[model samples]
Target: MTAHEDPDEDIPTGLDAAVTVKVAGVDQQRRHAELVKEIDDAQEAYYGRDKPFITDALYDELMLELQKLEAEYPSLRTPDSPTQRVGAPQEETDFSPLTHPSQMLSLDDVFSIDELKEWMTRTEAALGHTPEWLCEVKIDGLAIDLQYVNGRLQTAATRGDGRVGENITPNARTIKAIPQRLRPDPAQDFLALFEARGEVFVPLKEFAAYNDKLADQGKPQFANPRNAAAGSLRQKDPRVTAQRPLSSICHGLGVADGLAVTRQSDAYAVMKAWGLPISPYNKVVHSLDEVLDFITYYGQHRHDLIHQIDGIVVKVDSFAEQQQLGVTSRAPRWAIAFKYPPEEVNTRLLDIRVKVGRTGRVTPYGVMEPVQVAGSVVSSATLHNAYEVERKGVLIGDMVVLRKAGDVIPEIVGPVVEMRTGAERPFVMPTHCPSCGTKLASEKESDKDIRCPNSKSCPAQLRERLFSLAARSAFDIEALGYQGADAILRAGVLDNEAQLFNLTPEQLVTVPFYTRGATPRELKEPALVPPPGIRDGRVLSANGRRLLENLRTARHQPLWRVLVALSIRHVGPTAARALAARFGSMDAIRAAGVEELADTDGVGLIIAEAVRDWFTVDWHLEILNAWAADGVSMADEKSARPAQTLRGLTVVVTGSLQDFTRDSAKAAITDRGGKAAGSVSRHTDYVVVGENAGSKQARAEQLGVPMLDEAQFRELLEHGPTPASETPASETPAPETPAPETSAPTTRASGAPGTPPETRDRRS
Candidate 1:
């Protein structure tokens, strides 16, 4: 069991006779047997060995189910069951053991907001009154108990089975955060014996850097910070632990004699005075509302902190109240951990499948048993390429770790090796394209990405390109989505996107899927009949008409948008805009040499080469000619420029703006000749912050750069910044505080249409 695996906490609510369950039958008995075997195997792997075969979420779910079964049928309860033990016994024979002075316990964990509220309410009722709560970040790290005798350090141990633990005093001494001797006051007598409880961890940034270093050295990297810290501290040689930059934060007390502290917060202050590390984020809250606020604040800013925190630990502040509430068999009744939704989860890898992208590059993705993670349900994750699949060591039918951070794409971290059964089979990359039978080969000699060389005629590639053309960043065609693109190609309406604008209602009516109240699948049904309101034998659907309308409107959508729709490799909006600004016309861009194209600002050598090569392809140029013949504008018309009020200034806009889309916001700044930078720096003149504006806002504050809200940003856009002498000091916003209308943003690169700014190009 991991740190948060105490049975008292792991059991889901209403499993304790509050809700009725069907009586256990043969099916329940078989399920109970399966659950016990799985839970026992997981605990043995995690505690007995140091490898975890399953995620904390999976383990909790198993435990919940097991407890529910046991609750429903008392006959199934066994003394050797996982729920009956504090933790699996320590099996590390190399390390000497030491019995702890007192039992070190795990805190009860609550997952949802309602569960947290219920725990708080139950605690208040038991205490007879509301007690002050001490809230602190529950760091995701290994728990340790440091024993001190007569103001001097003695021994340090892990919380192995609570009563006894592995002796790691030599390795513990290597950590600078652990004080060797207590700083006693001359005016008062210090406790002769004291036990300091803390969580040992590695800083998030340092851990990432260290992982990179390890990868560079051709060494296997640790999976996470918690695992890194645990492995670093458990080294047989103390010098090995010394080499690792392990840090710790003291949180609770184990055993203290003659301590005069009346509250947990006071104990932390006393511990800090004694040179013990305590969390800077620890706070004393007088009410449940304040506790909830603290949780909410940390939940939003969890990534901004130095270390990883999985949850918030809320404890009864007063020692008297805590003592009265006392302890459960495995955890302290006075404290509970409000766990956030998991960012990483374990699920069965059902199969590995390959997908062909617009460029014909083949990427493998894992099909998983759908699991909820990071506030969403994800069933598939991209593996990038064949090499990535091999490197991750994931086999079909194995349980794999899936991670999704906020709104980012979900990815399979790696496979759990210990859980692999003999039935698992390694994935083999296909030699031929799945959609169109074309032999796959690397685009360049050194390129790891394999592609179908038949890019022009490959149905998969053409379909993907059509979808890209209709994306928001390209033609912004809403009606011609994936389904429409696939339907058009399958119905032989168009062989490729070259004839996208040539589509007519008469041609669309022939494709049953595009006709009113008729589907391609149902068209073959002999008894199937079309819905009412048909003009002739068939009529174009609303979506079909809308597609034609959108296609017409897309014809004049600026020269840059056309460049984006052409599917030129590396020629995204940023490079397209640069080319448009310099060349002005498609004819000039086609006639320009690679050196001239590369000379354009923001258009690098790679993008220039892609553009020069694209014009050389006879088929690519044929599409351009076809679109131009269909009345699509190939050149941008000259127009008067906006007032250059912000000519020399560089501004960064972050978060969602009510009046502007991400691209429109950038246009607003660039129209006035101001530089719209993605990231914040000391050179940034202003940072326009909007709703949910994340890390860019934080970086602006760190660099002491001024921030403006949507309203102030409008003022700045209309007229340049007011001089210091002209503006009143009282009216100015402090560098620390963003404007009242906007909250701080995160490090998330870019958001959806009404979301944050881009750290990278806002490409489809």
Candidate 2:
């Protein structure tokens, strides 16, 4: 009988109409069974193998449909139904036999803040003490198990189905942060077999860059960094993995034969020292108050950090305590991941406004009634692109769900369809630039990213350009902040970025002052400093004279600084540096062919086109040339002699150095052709550890890597390169130490190379 027909409608006797209907019901049942099998297979491939062919939304929809079918037809439900469980069965593995001494388990998810708080309360009640919580960034990436045998690297495996994992030792070794060998610690005699569990992830900026490069080369891009990292690690060739910016941070420890650590913090320190990257933001809090404070702090400042963190992992500090706490069937009892709820708020979409950015990209922003979300009052949220607006079906005067994903920026998640009234108006992407009234154009083959054809003379674009020029990293112009620039703009004295040079003391005297939270007030005319080679009745001191000189000289600042100051979309400080380093001069860069520009390392087609488009505008070229003509110095004349002693070596400096500040210590490494990385690794040739050095020193010992005290580090500097044979053994003699009280001189030479004179003066 067909599945749609009632089973009791007819008996299979002598050619009756009801019997034929029942036969139709039987056919429908067979079709439903086939669909269930198909879905189950797909689920197995996705969750079990970590290789999903279908989109998450599609998979979810299919599973929901399957669930509904099973509910409707109880007899169709099977033991292996997708709706019955959280994950699929583990795939068979062929790797060498290895057993986890302490079984690694998955986390039990608590979706909301209230749930997390409840979990904490329950744990405290069970323990009979306020457990010290160590909060760490919950990185959304691939989990890997690293095993170190006798202080040496042995194996690395993917967390496949909790019980077993795919062996990825070669790929793991290519990750520069992972240690190849453990430092020898005489104090810890039992640490022979050590296992560290962590997530491997790509930083957001690097991932974006990688995707951009892929697009430029006409290759498909991954959806997100997590997927990118996973795919890269799973590649058969280790060399491919090395090219990706895959980094790992140890969040928990597993079985260790040689280690005698009693606490989670000690394990973290050991992991960090051994050169496996541990989260820099990891903190140990003795009280629940401190734990909440850390969560709040990280939640607010999440965007500023490099990597993407979805939530914080809070774990019990004591290993013995953790052992006693033990595990449930699925998750560890000692720990729980405290997830910050998705930053989404229900708000009425009042209106839609189009904004033209500095790069002339037209973005649709939603004007909303003020709503408090994640401790901030947000009045507006970004619509991202025309496609997003249409996909979300966002409409004017509609109640919409606004979200700030990763705390990056507020964006309209979707419109609330259930609450929609007939008054809601559909939004259409604009055909003209909102700022300059130029025609908006879209690249037909690419995603819908609307752009203004007016490359220059846009008021909004110019304001951003000027702001970029006056930013702290660019010109070190203390007087020209956002408010100051706005005041300048409001005075009706300046129309473009170039008009700033034409301003006089009389013009400046008319500028208004607006205190942060107060009404605007007329400034009590402070005595002004005249520009260089121009004198007015402005009272000037030595410092004032210096400031004016610096301001005039800023016009000729380095090409890289100028590029950064322009605030091009998708271009950051690192990209600007790469551009400047390659081109050497602005004129050469502007004149270069598009393909040639694209061929430059780190400069993709999009950025290359952006650079070309920026320079194509006559006014932009005129302004740059005007600055050059007005005596801005764009080149560095002095070059430091290369120190061959430290070439290609990675060094870590910890604690206070005798002859240098932290910055200077880093500079010393750079000046000597070595990289001063923040953490220790097997690749690290030396660790310049100072007095009161804690975690890093311990790690260096565990890896059997040689550590240098401040005096020994200084000796290495003075004596030139130490040969492999001449290199001190692990038990080398200590050197003469300097007095702790002696403060090092803050000389100009000690400053960071290429730092502007204005910044150096401010530091002094």
At residue 16, give the lDDT of candidate 1.
Answer: 46
lDDT tens digits by residue: candidate 1, 1-764: 22221223333246643332345566877888899888766543432222456767888889898888877776565433554432222222245777899998988889988998999999999988889888888899999999888776667899899999998876776675576556665543568789999999987766877888887776766767887899988987766776676877788998887788788888876776665766666778778778887787677767756678889999999999989999999999999999988888899999999999998899999999999998899999999999888767789999988988767799998887789888999999999999889999998999999999898999999999999998887889989889888988988989888898898766777676667654555555524543332434455677777777898898887787899999999888767766776677899999999999998766778999999998999999889999999988898776743455676688898877899988898877865657789988767888887776666776766556777777787888788777631232234463342211111122222111112232211110
Q: Single out the weakest 10-residue window by summed lDDT for candidate 2.
A: 738-747
RMSD (Å) per prediction: 17.6, 17.6
lDDT of each: 0.76, 0.63
TM-score quality measure for candidate 1: 0.77
Residue-level lDDT for 726 in candidate 1? 22
Query: What TM-score should be assigned to candidate 2?
Result: 0.47
TM-score of each: 0.77, 0.47
| Overall local distance difference test of candidate 1 | 0.76
Error of 1 at 678 (Å): 4.3
Best by lDDT: 1
Q: lDDT of model 2 at residue 238?
A: 65
Q: Runs in model 2 with CA error above 4 Å?
A: 1-342, 443-447, 476-478, 513-553, 567-571, 638-764
